[model samples]
Target: MKKVIMGNHAVSYGVRASEAKVISAYPITPQTHIVELLSEMCANGEIDAKFIKVESEHSAMAACVGASAAGSRAFTATSSQGLLLMHEMLHWAVGARLPIVLANVNRAVGPPWSIWTDQNDSLSQRDVGWLQIYCESNQEVQDTIPQAFKIAEQLQMPVMIVMDAFFLSHTFEIVDIIEKEQVREFLPPYEPEIKIDTADQHSFGNLAGPDHYMELRYMIQEAMDRGLDVIKKVNKEFEEIFGRGYGLIEPYRCDDAETILVTSGTVSSTTRAVIDELRDEGVKVGSLKIRVFRPFPTEEVFEVLSKAKKVAVIDRNISFGAHGIFYQEIKSALYGRTDIPILGYIAGLGGRDVTPKVIREIADKAIGDEQPERYINWIGVKI
Candidate 1:
């Protein structure tokens, strides 16, 4: 059915469609609606699942890890400081190879304390061994949740579906929620190929000797490496069933363009409008909405971006003493290739509005010939 739903509600619908057997979470602003809706569903018997209420985000994820280890499909949602609290268990969930799905409402990490949007929280945990999918729209948020579960379980890794804190999370949009029966047909039940069984009584998470430890880590790497193809396969099946196709990285108007803007999350929507306006004016500008951030998708990014005359990276998060977090990654990906110049535009932090006009200005600057000065250029800021 089609309805105007908030991103959080869309996520809850996806979780229901995915048929999560165990949902555990603590309430955090911008992300609270997700857990609240799930709780109500569980209370109303809309979903046949156990909604575990924990004290903190840390315990929420810890309990989820335990539930997942016990061979149940577990899930959680958090934002900002809440995500920071889940830091330790994030490693545990991945190290134990638990197929847990987490919906991360992206918010700026605080020192002065703010509750707006930024990608710093999730990007900070880039090495935590979870398959990270940055969402562009509420529809993607709803669609990717089920796919995240399938991909995570298939690879024995956790997955984090990231959406902007307020932009997509709280904003209402018309989304065609996938049907329950169809999702059930597409994503099978979660039965881990390798699991801890009471019948077997084997010790899990035992300290491996040097001989076995390195190999175990190597095995995890292999699983992540293979997840690229696995993600593609799952997306293909999802598209076939729902007639909505997606990729690890979605390219917008990249074909025959001399320059491309690389971004993720809700900002991609703004860039799309900017690109269309530029196209109508006979200016060749395009965009690449990076969905999968962890495995980095270096090959696909290179193939799509390397040939362009210039590439502008607009990031919501900045790494201290470096360029925009994603901009740096793009630079590293395109290193040693002198074909395309890389420009960094850091914008939309702490819930600042990144309008189409701002994106157009950035695109105009990117397509121009200027000596690259600062690695990080602040956009939408008063000089």
Candidate 2:
């Protein structure tokens, strides 16, 4: 059914469609609507799931870990500090090899106390071994949930579906709500060979001696390596069923372009508008929206970026003292493959509006021969 829904509720609907057996989350700004709707669904019997009202975000994730270990399809949502609070447990979920899916409404971290949209919160958890997929719209956010479950359970790794805070979370959009019956075709019930079964009981996350710990870590990496192909396959099957699909990375009009804008999340929509405007002005430009972050689409990124003469990455989050998070990943992806001057522009932090003009400025800077005065340029900063 087609419906105009907020991004948060869209995720809620996806969880419902997935037939998730356990949903536990502590509400945080711009992310509360997701769980709030889930709570109502539970209360109204719309979904056959247990909604655990946990005290803190930490406990929320812990509960999810416990439920997932018991072979339940677990899910949760959070933002900014809430995600940060779940840091240790984030590791717990990964180490335990549970297929819990988390929807993180990307928000800026605190110091000045901003609750607006940014990718820092989720990006900070990059190394925790969760498969991270950033969304460009409400539709994608909703759609990715069931796919996340399939991918997570397949690889025995948690998946984090991230979206901009207010930009996507609060904003409403028309989405084709995939019915549960159809979603079930794409995402089958998760029945892991290993679960907290009393009959076939075995210890999970038990003490591993140093001789075995390194190999276990290697196996996780091995799963991540397999996940790249699994993700593509799952997305392909999803499209076959739902008629909508998103690739690992979306490259727009880059075939004959001299420069490209690299972006993720809602900001990519604005970047697309800028691409068209520049094209009208006789400038060869394009945009690449990174829908998948973790299991970073290295080959796909290399293929698209190698064609462009120069690439400008617009990141809404910074790694602080290093580079824009996405920028670093892009460079790493392209390193040793091409000398296609991949530039970095840090914009939209703490929810600052990254208007089209800002994107234009970044594009102009990227195409020029001034050689980017610095590795990372702060776009739209007043100072």
Candidate 3:
């Protein structure tokens, strides 16, 4: 059924469709509505689930961890500092191999205080072993929840569904809401091989000694290594059933393009418009939206980008001293494979608007410069 809803409610509907058994979250700006609606659904019997209201984001995730450990489909939502508070439990979810799904509205981390969109919060948890999917629209955001659950259960790893704060979270759009009946066709009930059971008890996340610790960590890496294929398989199955498929990396008009812009989240939509405008004027530029961040999609990214003359990455999140997070990943992916000039542009930090003019400027620079003057470039910064 089609319904006009904001991104947060879209997430709630996704969780509803996924039939998550345990929904636990602490209210945080931009992300609160996601769980708020789920709470309502639970209360009204629209969803047969337990909506656990917790005090802090830490406790929210801890509650999810406990629920997921008990072999239930678990979920939660948070943004910015709320996400940061859940850092410890996030690692716990990954290390324990519990298939808990989290919807993280991408908000900028605060010092001076801001509730706007950015990738820093989720990016900061990059190495924690969660499969991260960044959504471009409310429809994708809603669809990804069930997909994330399927992917997580199959891999026995947690998944994070990330969306831009306010941009995708507060903004209303028409989404073809995937009903629970349809989702059940694609994502089956999660049945884990081993779970915390009282009758047939098994030790989970027990202390790992020096002899076995390395191997445990090795297995985690192994799962990550296999994540891409599993995600692709799940995506294909979802597309077959739902008639919509979002690949790991979506390359638009890239077959014969000279320059390609890399982006994620809501920025990808704006970048696509810029690409079309530039294309009409005879500029051979394309855009690549990275839907999946973890598992990196190195081979797929390389294949699409190697054909381009220049590549520019527009990052909404930066890694302090190093460079843009996606920029680093893109460069690493294409490092030895191709020496094409891959430029990195840090723009739209702290919810600043990444307008077409800004994207156009980056594209023009990338296309105009035979060799980029610097690896890292900042856009729309005041002195």
Query: Which candidate wins on lDDT?
Result: 3
TM-score of candidate 3 against the unseen true structure: 0.98
RMSD per candidate (Å) reads 1.3, 0.9, 0.9
- Against the true structure, candidate 2 reaches a TM-score of 0.98
lDDT of 1 by residue, 1-383 (tens): 89999999999999999999999999998899999999998999888899999999999999999889989999999999999999999999988999999999999988868889999999999888888999978898999999999999899999999999879999999999886688998899998755678776767899889889888888889999998999999999999999987798989999988899999988898899889999999998899999999878988999899768889999899888887999988988888866577899988888888888888878888887486545567887777
Question: Residue 254: error of model 1 in Å?
Answer: 1.3
Report lDDT (CA) for all predictions: 0.90, 0.92, 0.93
- Point out where model 3 deviates above 4 Å: 370-375
lDDT agreement of model 2 with the native: 0.92
TM for every model, in the order presented, reads 0.97, 0.98, 0.98
lDDT of 3 by residue, 1-383 (tens): 89999999999999999999998989899898998889999999989999889999999999999999999999999999999999999999988999999999999998969999999999999999999999999999998999999999998999999999999999999999999988889999888878889888998878889999889889889999999999999999999999998899999999999999999999999999999999999999999999999989999999999999899999999999999999999999998988798999999999999999999998988888765836578998896
Taking the tens digit of each residue's C-alpha lDDT, what string does model 2 give over 329-379? 999999898878888989999999989988888888899846763667888
Model 2 CA deviation exceeding 4 Å by range: none
